[model samples]
Target: MRAADPALDSLQGLALGDAFGDRWFSVPIDELSDALAVRTLRPAPWPWTDDTAMALVLVRHLITWGEVRQDALAGDFAAEYGREYHRDYGPAMHRVLRGIGSGGDWRAITSSQFEGHGSYGNGAAMRVAPLGAWFADDLDETVRQAELQALTTHFHPEAVAGAVAVALAAALAVRTRGRRAPGRAELLTEIAGRLPDSEVRSGLRIAARMPDRTSVRHAAAVLGSGLLISAPDTVPFALWSAAGHLDSLPEAIWHTVAGGGDTDTTCAIAAGVVAARTGLADVPPAWLAAREELPDWVAEVSTSS
Candidate 1:
């Protein structure tokens, strides 16, 4: 595979996982438990949500510029959100992106989120894995670019920390591919070291000590799965899922979905990191076939050398 393949592969995995996880929401509330346990939910043409939509924008921007250019990235994000308005974007994000589309200042609109506390949402982390894969050789650059990308729409320290953690996880997956898989402690510790002191960082510290055999329920209870849709609630568990199932994209995504909250975003985050190393080689053909096609622009980029 080419050096660029990891980023493309991560994008594919993220999108597929996002789409697959979204299908769970369609299941009846009563059947949800059985569906999750038996893995019997088979919804066709699984459409991805805002996770993949924003991720596509980020991937295309990086491919075109060879690095993140914040203003351009923000513009692309706003444009993509406008073009795909039906992709279930959160209300605050919808408002922010719409504001940007109308010629408002992205910095002002983004920083003004949540009464000026800024958004601590996992939106930042959901779209950043491919950036990490693209800059896999430089951990410092990966973290730097992740923060810059997060700042395009998310300004909270916790949100930026979530992006940094996910990006580093992807980068580490790429960096450690074909080597003995890094242990859970090693993965969490390395990611924690790159993060600032915050609740997100504190979560990683806790995650580092979590055993590999810990159940998804227990892990979710401890680390969260974006149940509250905050970065501090999401990034650690997704990373923990990715760390535990580094060599298995399906298993990583399954564990992510089983954890329940914000399933699409969590699965996207975990799948992207896992696929940075494993790629789509082991992904179920049926699942990949069911995912909606990526945007034409990104499809062209993926097929290129």
Candidate 2:
């Protein structure tokens, strides 16, 4: 059953999904690498990666301030990333975050990363659900705030699109709190219409057409399973999993994990979308208990205000 309170549902979904994804990291490197190729998951007690941690940072800001404060958000992300450096963060992100932790100019450090390419990673998308859930009554508000949240780390159009799509999807899901989830086509169309045309949107458009017909392997091949690590490669598969199993949070996470690639992120994204409609019920009790306890600040941020 979906929660009457949108915020808790969003947070729980995001957190559980993130935890599911991080489990990949604990496997022996050879096994983990092999699993990536075969589209398999080792199962739970998954230690969340950068996705959930950064998400917690955003949730804290929203719960405390009720709006995005880019610098503060950035500061919190950098600090958290530094403290938890072993999380599955990207190389570029690790460098930029470390620089920020050392008091370097965030803009200079992040922009200087990836040979000046900046990040086009799905990091922005992984943690944006609370913004969407909190502003479900206003799509424009969700989009606007999502942009603000993304700007702190991801500046590329594709990166922004990933964040926007996640936020939009979450917003739509939240609206389904007391009703049946929208049809797959309707869900995809609503998300695409609200999001500007981009690689992410195009992928989502393709995903909207899939409707659980494709095998997880085929979907990963077509939409990518996060192996490429870019928004275009990651977002589509995640959205497909979400759309295919919109009413079943566990199913969405399972599909995402089965797709392999970036299992954690895909699981996280799917969790966010599915949870919006189904609430925390989608999360398994054992899975929730097994996840590493979030930091005091993270828990506080989610509960603040």
Candidate 3:
């Protein structure tokens, strides 16, 4: 039998974590608080949101083409969003995908979002981890591919930075396989070296300085966790959680959830990175079973590849 693809493993971890984290969105504040206090998860059949949807599209494209071809990726993203319109896409993303589906120029549509300032949202970062693992042998290539992919829907520097950061984290995780997990300082140094000057980079630097024993609430207070849905607000905390919990996939995801902002995306990013190192063996069977199956095309590609 063929060995499982590491990239596919990362994607499964990402999608499952995305779905698992999403379950918290519907819980009452009191109930959520109680669950968190005990580190308990919500019920099963956890449905994923746009984070998994978009990541699957990217994974499918990679399996078919071996690299991100910008034009084809744009089309695939549009087609995926159009088919899965109920996945809670953000308004800005909806506009971009709709335009792309209608044959509008992807570059123009992406650059024109948010009144021409483009988007600084976490959308780009949410779906990019597998790309990192795919190019893990080449950190430079991972950053380049991550930027190209992010530019399809997000043109803002911060958004691109967030994508690059997550990609680097995943690549680093893959690189650390069978070795000791990277320390926070090592991970941050590598990521910061690749990232350009941006709020996301600054936030990651802050994350590096955060003590290991810091509580999630304290960490979240110092580093925002997507409460504003911006790259700067999310990537730092997600990376911090992933680095701290590289040995425990469930704990990494739980830390992301405990941070309490844009839970699904944060957990998705964190889980993807840690899973590159730990795979799904450490993830709870119940959580994996609860996630919706990945897109059929993604499964077909993985099987046939």
Candidate 4:
């Protein structure tokens, strides 16, 4: 039973965050802090990066299959990368995607990353919010689908845990929208309780305990804002920021950006979760106009194979 297309809303939010965050990378080192301090908005043509690109592929996959079909997903990931390798994908991905695109077994190729430890990179978590929204009504299935999709590229337990956490956050955000927002501590606990015991889960637990009034800089320093580009170093802070600003789309992105490291992915995670609840209803028209247009193929995409 399909419902309203909140996942599309999540995708848009993810893209906006991706593009907005990417712009910060261009700022002069000294100017970056001043820019962030002023809350100045990036101008038009905010082109998104790999986070949005991979997310689009995931959304298209869900529209075609309604759930993860791992082999096909692995192929789709490769195909998408093949078409557009300029989306600022992480270096590891270029290697991984090239291997998969060359007809190598995805499991073998992916499991072989990071010297056979597999990748615990934040890539799995960065692009999974829409999938979470897609199965928002049933959290068990949300975790199930999230894990499957993540396994296509990131085979490490921590990476899988990161994906599950973000997906759960997006699901809860959508489920609670237009209703009383859940307690931040309570919400983070619920998400943490559902995931395996890993640093990501541990960080989420810590995020649950932090005072909501904490500064983004402090929170990022503690929970991390993707500085390491690994799940343990990222997802906790993204979820924390999202939990704190579920009601405001723009503020959530801004706050997430203040954390600095891996700004694009952190902002993407937080924005996607917040927008799953708030939609673009509260987002300024100017901000929307500034974001580069989403792919044309996204409009009215039918949820059928």
Model 1: per-residue Cα lDDT at residue 298: 64
Query: Candidate 4 lDDT, tens digit per residue, 141-213?
Result: 9999999999999999999999999999999999997898888898899999999889999999999999868
User: By descending lDDT, how would the candidates be arranged?
Assistant: 4, 1, 3, 2
What are the clash counts of all predictions, listed in order?
0, 1, 0, 0
Candidate 1, residue 75: Cα displacement in angstroms equals: 0.8
Q: Which stretches of candidate 4 lie over 4 Å from their true place?
A: 1-4, 26-30, 302-305
Clashing pairs in 1: none
Ten residues in sequence with the least summed lDDT for candidate 4: 296-305
lDDT scores in order: 0.89, 0.78, 0.88, 0.89
Give, for candidate 3, the lowest lDDT window spanning 10 residues: 1-10
Clashing pairs in 2: 21-264
Q: Better model by TM-score, 1 or 3?
A: 1
Q: Name the lDDT value of residue 261 in candidate 1.
A: 80
Instruction: Report the number of the highest-lDDT candidate.
Output: 4
Query: For model 1, what is the alpha-carbon lDDT of residue 252?
Result: 88
Kindly give the stretch of ten consecutive residues in candidate 2 with the minimal lDDT sum.
Answer: 1-10
C-alpha TM-scores of all predictions? 0.96, 0.88, 0.95, 0.96
